[model samples]
Target: MRIVLATTLAVAFAVPAVAAAPARPARLGLCAACHGETGMAQIPGAPNLAGQQLDYLREALRQYRDGRRNVPLMRAAIGPVSEADLDALARWYSAQMPQTQGTP
Candidate 1:
């Protein structure tokens, strides 16, 4: 009985941790078209997002979503994003390792 109780408790605690792990945003491919999959910018004039402050990334996404930023492409891409998905994107981009040019 004690073993059963312990196992149940362990599973209960483990479940939330598993669920809390960040998921890849559904719109990642769209973002990746401009910003590389690891947050490096692939196109000219696009800013690199990797290693940016978490709060900054999150806020920038929010601004783009709410129309404050005013860039047509960003506004279009961020328009249909849900709050959870936005947060997930921010987390993903912010957690990436940044690559610098001319570095071996």
Candidate 2:
């Protein structure tokens, strides 16, 4: 009984702390200028970020940050983003439903 009780208490305390921090909002203010308010793009060249694969987005950001992909504007945009922020942003957009082409 004591073991079960202790285990229950431990699990309860452990889970919430991990769950508490929200990975930025679905609409990020900085991303909004090009990626639109909801991961959709309003800019001419920016691709829609909504519903992209998490791994793909993360890799792209990593590339941009590491200079493997050399689009000057993207490198500039990602320069200030930390690895954690990049992961958060990737998760944020990956969970969104993709907008259909020409739907707007």
Candidate 3:
């Protein structure tokens, strides 16, 4: 009886640690829709976000969030993001390799 109870308790604790693992932020998927998996923007007119300055990315998102920036799409896109998520995303993108426009 004691061994059975101990085993059950151990399994109960272990189950939650495996099941309740935190998921990656949702904004990362949103960013990937336009910006490639590597942070390089594949679509024309979309600026490459990879290797951008952290301050620049943060300020850009802030402007969109604050209604200072006039881009409706960007405003809607950034509307629900928390400041911490924005900073983390900015740091991630800024660390990627920058894409060059022309061939040598």
**For this target, which candidate reaches the highest TM-score against the unseen true structure?**
1
Off by over 4 Å in 1: 1-22
For lDDT, the strongest prediction is 1
Cα error of candidate 1 at position 21, Å: 7.5
Per-residue C-alpha lDDT of model 1 across residues 5-100, encoded as one tens digit per residue: 999999999999778656677779999999998899999999999888889989999999999899998999888788888888998898788987
Candidate 2 vs candidate 3: which has greater TM-score?
2
Tens digits of per-residue lDDT, candidate 2, 1-104, equal 99999999999998996686347653367677899766889888889998889899999989998999999988877786787788888888887778777744
Candidate 2 stretches with Cα past 4 Å from truth are: 1-22, 25-27, 101-104
lDDT (Cα atoms) of all candidates against the true structure: 0.88, 0.82, 0.78
| Ranked candidates (TM-score, high to low) | 1, 2, 3
* lDDT value, candidate 2, whole model: 0.82
Candidate 1 residue-wise lDDT at 44:
92
